[model samples]
Target: MGDFVKEILVKPIQYADEVVKLADGAISFRQDCLEVKTKSEKLVSLLRQAARASGDLYERPTRRIIDDTEQVLDKALTLVLKCRANGIARIFTIIPAGAFRKITQQLENSIGDVSWLLRVSTPADDRDDEYLGLPPIAANEPILCLIWEQIAILCSGTIEDRTDAAASLVSLARDNDRYGKLIIEEGGVGPLLRLAKEGRMEGQESAARAIGLLGRDPDSVEQIVNAGVCQVFAKILKEGHMKVQVVVAWAVSELAAHHRKCQDHFAQSNVIQLLVSHLAFETIQEHSKYAIPTKHAMSIHSVVMANNQKNDMDVTDANYRNNEQDDECKSKIQRPRGCQRIVKCTIW
Candidate 1:
């Protein structure tokens, strides 16, 4: 591979032409470019070689190639981005994630600024479960953060800074939107709930709806309820948009089943009726089965205890107790005279 890269690097113009031709498709393009068919196979091999090589010999040449846009290397960086954007997937098992981030940072700098580079780093929503199994950085923080920050910049930033501070203001949450520790602490649920309450119609609507989903987590609701958020959600339900209404109703149902105080308050506010009405249309009988064990267990215990009291059967009577056994057996066979009236009242 090093020999191949050396061969290509010697004639950089030819390498550059192939790289650009491969990446020149339209932005909305969805086709896969085969590495074996194009220079990607060779280029990926070269990247690995450059990574493995030590000292200034590798750095100087790699920097020169990355820095010069007039030749093949510049086009090669663009090609990597295009290949990634078109959904050419790979396992990072052979290559470390940090190496990928570093290489990608160089490519990001080389591309100047593109609106859709934002979308490239944003992992597919359906891919979240797969991502969560990855190491911490790849799963939790910078991947989504990079996407958010990039889109924020591309959508609203000036030429100098290139970020939408307003979008981050209204929508962003810290730490990959985990909302666990944050929602449990003081002031955790406030920002999202406030966004729903006070942000612009679109921002507020989305924020409010998100708050409703966040409410499903028990710790989050306990903190939000303790902070007096239910009333605010109730008001939002009365006047929020259709999406907000749907989310708020779902949120209310979640709150209702978990916190009795919240359920009572929601009932008094009349939101429970609305949530119940919605549930009637969407409910599955299996959904109610989750809570059945606790109810069934309580009912069985109550019936057993009540029947035992009404039976008047001695746990150890003359039929079971032996007089010759000991004083312990005699004591066990008799109830104390002081308890006679109580036993008669309960058992007879």
Candidate 2:
């Protein structure tokens, strides 16, 4: 009994120590971007908090504490991976773009090593069992293989896995129009919509971006709408984290641009009002492009006008008048002055 108690008590402290080491290693990695460095620092702070919290446990840690610690570690690791990916992408896009090949190769190797370390370090009991004993599926098309792999990860992997997979899918869809169509045809939309509606912070952001990218294809617009993406986007826009809200805004805007039915879906979901409310926040005002809200307002306005034109009966006159008033309000609302840069960015 004594030995057992000591083992139980010592394990958490040991795990905490490992986490600190991992955090240190992550911070030591070259972070040329300010965003990457800030994220690494924030990750270290979270790890410290988690370590302190774990150290307070004299016995075996409670379920709640273990879960909480796992959540923090998952978030930290996801941020680190995301920062590295972003840095790699940025290097590829830099002007003159010298040494990008070597830089990306190094970054990719580092990311692989870190990801492997994180997977192994995670407690066995916490690991998802669905990946066990599954034979890998082979495909002729590399993109199809990637889409399938990400779908599998999203379906049954941990939060970190889902987040990483979603981000990869987003990048894949963004880089190729054909890939986006293939993703839609391969039943990627359902899983992506599921993640967007029910995933963690990073998962939600990636899923929204993937959906947005997929929405760029006009053929996928109705499919996305049918998957209840508009409702999910409206909810995310209203209450999600800042990064997610911005992505969701862009996504819904893309969907709205594709077809009139998508616009109708957004109007029915009250997405216009939700977006208008987002304008009240300074963070949203800064990060969000105005094209989304501007286009959304126009979509809603068109819907109301069409409704009024169809319903000319005396009994519905009052309803038409109400809609007209709403349209007036939407029309009179001016775009934010800071949106000039966003417009230019979108155009380019």
Best by TM-score: 2
What lDDT does each candidate get?
Answer: 0.42, 0.56
Least well predicted 10-residue stretch by lDDT in candidate 1: 112-121
Which digits, one per residue and each the tens of the lDDT, describe model 2 over residues 66-162?
3433443444444344334445574553222333333333333333322322332343345564332211122235456566556656654667777
Provide the clash count, candidate 1: 5
Candidate 1: how large is its RMSD? 22.1
Supply candidate 2's per-residue lDDT for 239.
Answer: 78
- In order of appearance, the predictions have TM-scores of 0.30, 0.44
True lDDT of residue 231, candidate 2: 78
Give one digit per residue, the lDDT tens place, for model 1 in 58-165: 222233343342343554444444454534343322333344344444333323211122222233342332322222222345444343333333333333222132
RMSD of each: 22.1, 21.6
In model 2, the Cα lDDT at residue 74 comes to: 44
Give Cα distance to truth, residue 208, candidate 1, Å. 2.8
Best by lDDT: 2
